[model samples]
Target: MPTDIAFYTNPMSRGQIARWMLEEVGQPYDMTILDYDGTMKAADYLAINPMGKVPAIVHKGKVVTEAAAICAYLADAFPDAGLAPPVDQRADYYRWLFFAAGPVEAAVSNKSLGLTVPEGRERSMGYGSYDQTVTTLEKAVSGGQWICGDQFTAADVYVGSQVDWGLTFGTIDSRPAFEAYAARLRERPAYKRQKELDGALIAQMQKSS
Candidate 1:
């Protein structure tokens, strides 16, 4: 039997986020692993994602790109998975999801590259300042067991990835709240399964290289 979902990604990239989301959705998807310097930039994969990036998904013939978008898309596509909050009650869910994808992502990436906002230019940046963004993020996660409270929706998967990866890579501050939330996410079976699958793929790629 063929599945309608096709996942294009490299284990070493942010594709891990989508993989985790896929695992959480508990749906079968055929995955295509692309190499950064080669096939990813080739014309074939380019059609799926003009940017030639990993972590693009083709679901039922429609294309979805970007890790955060993919996470949210999967949640809605598979409502039975219960990964999204009720439609009318999704304010917080959408808030933190885009927050991580936008501000949090920008702040961390800029800091990693040693790029600062420069004096008086904080207002020019979407994240304002790295400190401000992380501080706000800390409060967001500290609000409840999940970003939207009690419900561990797709928001957790996206926001949690930012916190989890930030802690592991020293990209984001390891505040107590962040550490606690990440620890909880790590215990989820879906998170563990995603790590295991990606870990094995990473090892194989290393050995073959």
Candidate 2:
């Protein structure tokens, strides 16, 4: 398989999470920045990712989409990064990864869009309600330093992104556990690298536009 990886993203999007994962893996890769109105919706880009979304990666002649999936894939692909948990610890790793990607994402996003899951339908919806989602989520992750326990894994990339974004936008509650967790996430070398690089890219884009 070809080792070269191509990352498709815009500096201001969730692609930052995938960029952090790539940095943690410490591999050289190419990045393609797409503007919302320009190349993002073009036919060629759509062929690589039907959704035309930011944060997609092409490696080993395979395309990987979705932030959490990309994070987990890079972690396992580059085991030297030590970002993937051992088999025994994978339960929590996978649990929180999918939880953040699915329920947490839906709850937070829907809430942001001003859509409610409705009062009686909490039991029916996968995410329950926004309040219940964030509350239960805090217990599972915020209380602990990392989702899979002490050693941070790819799970942190996904979970931390949600937490950091939520706290920044005030979409989620500013609980003590959350503040402490976001603070720790911002301290990571890889995360900082992503912030610096993406920040500069965002600035450059803004100036050029």
Candidate 3:
């Protein structure tokens, strides 16, 4: 029997990354849409994630929070999707995947909040500076057709989503390399399908509200 997967997320958050990864995994998952100020903070949801985050998942009775973690988990859980490299060949995968979640997330969020680390405090911050983080990501994704070089693994799903959303929201600079890489990821069928589904869900929610 297929493992039971329950995806708890909102349509407007980083949950889209997990949804796209789920599509790539080719697994049937039941989605429970949670509101930002409503069900997301309820006791039942808080049990899965104390932080009351929007993108969390329950798979086979195990809960996974954070968008990158959910994507990584789905890739490993459905190895048939080929969304992951073998354990011994996961150096690039782990590096960029976690880098996107850490530095990329920090840089974008901090910049959007009009917060910047002073030059003297660059060493204290994990992302150094937004420019440094963006340039490094540009080089990383520009290395080849994909983040892992020649494979469209879960790394692309996580990292590419960050780049794409950053560019859209003016959080990250629109570097040529980032634009190109994001383009490649957007052309995937799974990404397109995930966008369509989430777009519809958002429209429905808007209409009801």
- By lDDT, the best candidate is 1
Show the lowest summed lDDT stretch of 10 residues, model 2: 140-149
What is candidate 1's TM-score against the reference?
0.99
| Number of the candidate with higher TM-score, 1 or 2 | 1
Candidates ranked, most accurate by TM-score first: 1, 3, 2
lDDT by residue for model 1 (37-98), tens: 99999998999999999899999999999999999999999999999999899999999999
Q: Stretches of candidate 3 above 4 Å error?
A: 1-3
**What is candidate 2's lDDT per residue for 1-209, written digit by digit as tens?**
33499999999899999999998889999989998887888999999988988889999788999999999999989898899889887988998899999999999999999998766888888899998889987987754678877988999999999999999999999998898889999999999999999999999988998
The residue ranges of model 2 lying beyond 4 angstroms of the native Cα positions read 1-3
C-alpha RMSD (angstroms) for model 1: 0.6
Error of 3 at 152 (Å): 0.7
Ten consecutive residues with minimal summed lDDT in candidate 1? 144-153
User: Candidate 3 lDDT, tens digit per residue, 1-209?
Assistant: 45499998899998899899999998889899999888999999999999998798899899999999998998888898999988999998999999999998999899999998987999999999998998888877988898777888999999999999988888889888888888888899999999999999999989999
Q: Positional deviation of 42 in candidate 2, in angstroms?
A: 1.2
Q: Rate the local accuracy (lDDT) of all candidates.
A: 0.96, 0.90, 0.90
Candidate 1 clashing pairs, residues 3+ apart or interchain: none
Query: Residue 190 of model 1: what lDDT?
Result: 99
| Model 1 per-residue lDDT at 165 | 95
Indicate which candidate wins on TM-score: 1
